[model samples]
Target: MRSWAEAERAEVGRARLRVSVLVALAIALMIAFVGGIAYVVMVHAQETQVSRELRYNARYGVPGIAPRCAWVFVLEDGTLHEGDLEVPRGFPLRDDIDAVHASRGSIERDVKANGTEYMVLTAPGADGTTVQAVFDLRYQLLDRAHLLLALAIALVAGLLLAALVGLTISRRTVGPWAEALARQRRFVTDASHELRTPIARAHLRAQVLAAGLPADQRTDLDALARSIRGLADVVDDLLASAQLQERRDRVPVDLTDVAEAAVVGETERATERRITVLLDHPGRPVLVGGIETGLRRAADELLANALRHTPEGGRISVSVRTVAGQAELVVADNGDGFHPAEAERLFERSHRGPGEGRFGLGLALVREIVTGHGGTVEAVGRPGAGARFTLRLPLAEAGLPVGGEHMTGACP
Candidate 1:
């Protein structure tokens, strides 16, 4: 399974690839459309110029005026009239002359002979004769071919340029997200490290004071010790969650053992709070491939969250089982639940409920750890009812015996 960072990078790469492809396609299409229109307009203008020159040569009888223009005069009886203009051979044929005479009006057509193209025009002459003019289209056709080649080259270059630009834009857009994630991870690591010294000193000082204090003053010291331990746990969670993002090791870990261990770890806190904490699990192991330490921290976070929310005398249960080839670890608490709409948001960093007395990183850390393991975690509950957090992980193919034991501990 891919780590969280790897998965996020993959998603970003896919998005960038899509954007680049779309941008290049759009640019290529626009270039092709514009080039096509320009080509048509240019070709039409050249053709119009040829036709106008033909008309001018026929009317003015310009001799040797244009090399490619050929004109001949023919009588109404379909007999050719030799004129001053030198007509090219194989042009304005007898058939063409006859067709003009039959029409008895202006006629325009294209003629191809000996692999050469010509635009021909026929009109009635002044003395009851017909005049036919032809213009060569070879140069114009060559010009059009050149235009097509240029357009193709421009299209290819434009697509390449657009692809480069699109890739640059995509990287620029996604760079900040990667940087922010890195900075957050760094902050978590730094903060966790910075907090350890003070937390250890406080814990040691509290222990010394509790040892020296009389029985009457011991209760307050114990409470202080608990609060310090909770802070230390929070610090440890912060560090673990930050490191989990980069953790790539995986092994067959029995979630049952992780869950049972978490419940056993929280027994003292549950007893102090006067809350009933129960652990229910199948006798068999529920194996999953993941970082055992991270999974244990996730289970610990869930149980800690429940212990925090549940009221005195309220019930909290941690259950582990397998369902449909998936390992499920569920933590349910009969506490003052949050608003239904806020269930999803509760897992966001630093998001705390009213009077929850938490920094709100526990659930967020749990979610991060679970997702890094290719698993999912969700919360469900309503105000005045209980809350249930379910975590599901893909189960290993075969159950890996882990400690070969089960925890059925319930603290009163």
Candidate 2:
């Protein structure tokens, strides 16, 4: 039990770790995306500002600037003349030369060897010549990078705060459900213990009276004894339900052994009803989890159900085998079949078959026991056809693959 509890806690912890990792990754991506956009916008804005400044400086030559008109030129015959002197630079242009030339606005090139950017603009000169200006732009790029770093730090702090809040909220939401389940279990354990005394006494009294009654009164006494037996079955179911609610962990058992025991017990009980019991094993031991008593009681419930519904000479077969690596126990009978829809509510407490007195809680108790053992129980029946009750239990660790089979899709 302790080991099962520890395993559940470990599973929860792993889920929490996975969620935290996903949250951290999301936060990182958000920071990177926002920071990258900010950096690009800052660089473009700085480049536009430098272009405008250079254009204004070119149009008015700034007063007292040397070479203000010295390098101003005219182009004729596809050749440039600089102030009536031969042009030193070409009329067209060299792409890499760090010289300013002008058309509508001045254009210039300024290349730095280490860690700097440059911008250029060309404009129409005042004397119908062209002027250009250039300026370094490395400072603007560095400023944007620093701003992005600060923003990212703030966002990371915010994400941490949000994650903490989310964790607290989730814990509070699920805590009540956990407590309620625990309380219900304890109640079942206590209630079953209290109810057992009277039921045992009643059974004993019935047995005593049956032994002492004369033949003339035996018929009446037999009816009374049958009623007592019916009551005993109900008490048994209640006790099983209590056990299931109390133990959240499963106790391992061998299904083949359980099926063998059930066959013997059912055969003895059904002798008076003329019901036949056939037991089949796969010849291989299939290990599963559940208290032996609990599993037997569950199987007995199904057997009793089949005996009651099935006509005389109908056969009941109990089979235990391995299916998809899990222990599978099936109880099938050639009984007057049931409605397919009823299969779902067949295990519900207080449900019964048509024309049958009241045997609803039997299947319900069976389900509770199977579920508590970390197994599953299901009923399959169609009208006018035989019925089948199937139980599946997870395989022991020794029987599982390297990491153990996943039970997610085993049952609802």
Write down the TM-score for model 2: 0.53
lDDT of 1 by residue, 173-287 (tens): 7778767877877787888878877887888788889999998989879778756765676666556556646543467888888988788778888999899988899988788
Candidate 1 regions exceeding 4 Å error are 1-141, 155-248, 265-278, 303-317, 333-362, 379-387, 397-412
Model 2 clash pairs are 104-123, 105-122, 105-123, 106-121, 106-122, 106-123, 107-121, 107-122, 351-360
Give the Å error, residue 31, model 2: 8.3
Cα lDDT of model 2 by residue, 180-290, tens digit: 655765676567566666766665676678779787877656666655554555544444444533342344567887788667656655676677888899887777754
Model 1 pairs in collision: none
Error of 2 at 336 (Å): 8.0
Per-prediction TM-score, please?
Answer: 0.58, 0.53
The lDDT for every candidate, in the order shown, is 0.78, 0.63
